[model samples]
Target: MRLPILLLTLALPLLSQGQTADDIVKRYLDKIDGSKKWKDVKSMITKGEYDYGGIVFPFTTYAKAPSQYKFVVPFNGKYYAQGYDGNSGWKIDAFKNETTPTLLNGSQARAMANEADVELEIPFINYKAKGHQIKLEGRDTLDGKQFYIITLLKSGGEKETYYFHSTTYSLYLKKSIAKNIELEKALLDT
Candidate 1:
């Protein structure tokens, strides 16, 4: 009897340590200024410095609701532009000796389409409608700050893990399964 009682006591804390993904997502949206405000927004524009390859490149992005995105980066003297217009996407890149504007295909096109629809309010707004699955990975700590870890698994098997503030609900970080130049405007004010 003592053995069973001891085991049950230990299990109680572990059981209460986790929450359903839906519950976490709902609370997160509520904490981040609610969904009512998100409905009114149709577009967003942000300008910030991009840190990559040890060089800081300034970038500006314009996004339209549903599926449209454009990013312009001035390199050296020319502006490299990339935009996704609904079903198609294009890129104006700088080459070694020449600059070229080319259309994107396959996964690149699809990724751009997905990125184009990013809203300022958190990605989990219509998560279910988008056929994305969420899993709560409990909590973690970094630099002495605690964060709630939630993983979003996309339909195509792409996974992105989001770390949110454990108490304040602010977005702490996100790790993608692959290395891609993604525009994360809604969170970083960039």
Candidate 2:
């Protein structure tokens, strides 16, 4: 989904040298979310496309504070839905002949649960309190542009690497790899 306001705030500058991970994170957050507007958001609805392989599906996402989220996508004349109610994670895969909500378990469940909790605020905000660790992994270049690499180690041991534009200080890309699980869990659970 498009974050219109945050996208418009990407003009901030980055640290020059000897910047710690925390310092970089603070500046990044301040630039894009200085007003802390997300704190006042109790709920949100985002409509977008879900790209699967080379195909795409139109989807609508519903999120409410304190851990509630749902997304529905229509495919082949049927609607498929997945969500986490305040208590449990569930999904209905119409293609699999599952028309009713089925409780999720294992990594899938934990991933969804974690997503509901984190989506209320921007990622990296209070990351230590969230049991995540960050490190400045030096710099890297992608397509001729310089970027600062910051890696986040999740409590679950999942690793996510964020690429921030060196000059603009905007997030350019994020890459993640599951430490143990077969499927890599996404930071946004996207």
Candidate 3:
């Protein structure tokens, strides 16, 4: 009897550990402030400036609920457009910027579809149901700030690591190796 009781005590932490990860993600979604409003928002336009290595580039992300998106990025003085229009994904010329529109299918289109989710949901929500996997990789300090390292493995086989504020649970950074995109945009208005 005493041995069984002792075992339960030891197992409690492991049980709660799984829940803590879910709690962290839920709190994060609450902190950001959206849900029903996001559902009602048929379209959203996020305007902001992206700066890298001391250079600032103005950009905008437009999204429609469920999965429609269009974003423009400036490169070498011209703007490049990319988006998924519900039916299919497309990309404009990078050199001429707007001279041509090309169809995007397969992995590239799938990536765009993932990004095109206008709700901007907390990835952990229904993650398992969607066939995705998430792992909370403990906590640590980065650049003098504390953060929780969460790794997200998408159903599509893409993997991303996200750093969230340890206390606030707000996402501070996201890195996707497959996409080769490392974005830190909390300070930017997006």
Candidate 4:
């Protein structure tokens, strides 16, 4: 009897943690954009700079719903581009001397297609339906600032961890590892 009661007390916190994780994600999403508006998102275009080994290159990304995407980077007066046009994937790399648009195949094509698919929707919105899982990993400090740590396991086995502001509930940092690629993004303006 006492053993069972002790077990229940221990399990309660564990169970509540999952619920709390879900609630935190919901609040973050609502703060970014309501669920209804998230679903209505059809396309997005983002222009930014990619820094590689101290070299900064301007890049543009275009994505559309139903799986369409294009990424372009201009260098040395030449354009390097990758795109998935709903059905097929293609690329043009000036450094590789592939001036003509080359149709991507095999893993390359699949990777580009996957990017388009994910670009259509923001993760954490209907994460369960998307076959992903999220968990609250307690609190942590980043850059001398306190934050709530949340980790997301994507359906494809990728892992992503997010840091939300302890008080604002806004996402402050995100780190992800997918297919041998690791990326860390800071959302200071977000």
Candidate 5:
């Protein structure tokens, strides 16, 4: 009798915790800015600093219709530019070695390049819950508030696992897997 009661006590809290994480993901999708505003935008210009492997690089991107885009990265007193402006793709290096009319064939690379228009809309899109595998991993206190862990899996093989503030439903961290690189490489080679 004692064992049965103990199991019930432990299970009740686990069930509630899973529900809390699911609620947080739902609220976050409905309220975030990126998901809503970016989906409809046709063109944009963005300037920011990209930090990779502890090195900071100044970057700028411009996008237009029909797969037109320009990306510039400045590092160590030089600038590198790459783009596809409707007709063809091109690159200009620090030494001014120009490569124009270069074909960009990899699906993953093209998808990544095209994603500039969609990234800002992530917060506002209505993500259909095909299914959910929720777990109450653990809790962390940050800036005097606590957060819950939630993982969401979409039917299309895209996964997002995020940490949401318990009180605000605001996300602190999110991980997603998009596009398959092996298939992309094979496409590029052909």
Candidate 6:
């Protein structure tokens, strides 16, 4: 009876551990627009700023269904556009010159392009789960809320670290390193 009780106590922690990991993943997915929402989207326009050191460069991205995307940077007055018309992948830069067919080597670019597609709604579908490892880095008090640190790996050698709110399960921060560059920023700006 004593041995059984000890084993059960140890198993309880393991069970809870698995549940916690699953909950974290679910919460992360829920925070983003899910697959269903993605599928119905016909177009998307994202306006954001890319920070390089202390300089902030504003960029606007527009995407139409069936693989048409245009990224415009007003500061440079140019558009870097790409599309797959069900046959080939081509790009046109600010020079109004078309680029030869090029394949994307990094997962980040592919993910971003897919997100721009109206047909493919899932944002992280290109990412494969390599493994799940949890670590308690430390408590971060931000805007009067605490967060937990977690990391997830992808099969394509990409890693994303996430900081999630301890109470709300909302993501506070996320960071990832891309392995390749599909588009040159300078070329786009020109």
Top-scoring candidate (lDDT): 4
> Per-residue CA lDDT of candidate 6, range 11-66, in tens?
98566445464466566667765455666777777665554444656666676777
lDDT of each: 0.72, 0.71, 0.69, 0.74, 0.57, 0.53
Q: Higher-TM-score candidate among 1 and 2? A: 1
lDDT of 3 by residue, 32-92 (tens): 6645444455777776655655566666788877788887877676876788888888887
**Top candidate by TM-score:** 4
By summed lDDT, the worst window of 10 consecutive residues in model 2 runs over 178-187
**Cand. 1 TM to true fold:** 0.62
Q: What is the lDDT of residue 44 in candidate 4?
A: 89
Candidate 5 per-residue C-alpha lDDT over 1-190 given as tens digits, one digit per residue, 9 for 90 to 100: 9999999999987775655654666676666653455567777776655444455556676876546677677777777776766655555666365444344556634653543323333432454543435555667776777877666565444555567787677877654432323122111100
Better by lDDT, candidate 6 or 4: 4
Give me the overall lDDT of model 1. 0.72
Count residue pairs with overlapping backbones in model 6: 0
Clashes of each: 0, 0, 0, 0, 9, 0
The predicted structure with the larger lDDT, 1 or 5, is: 1
Pairs with steric clashes in candidate 6 = none
> TM-score of model 4 relative to the true fold?
0.67
lDDT agreement of model 2 with the native? 0.71
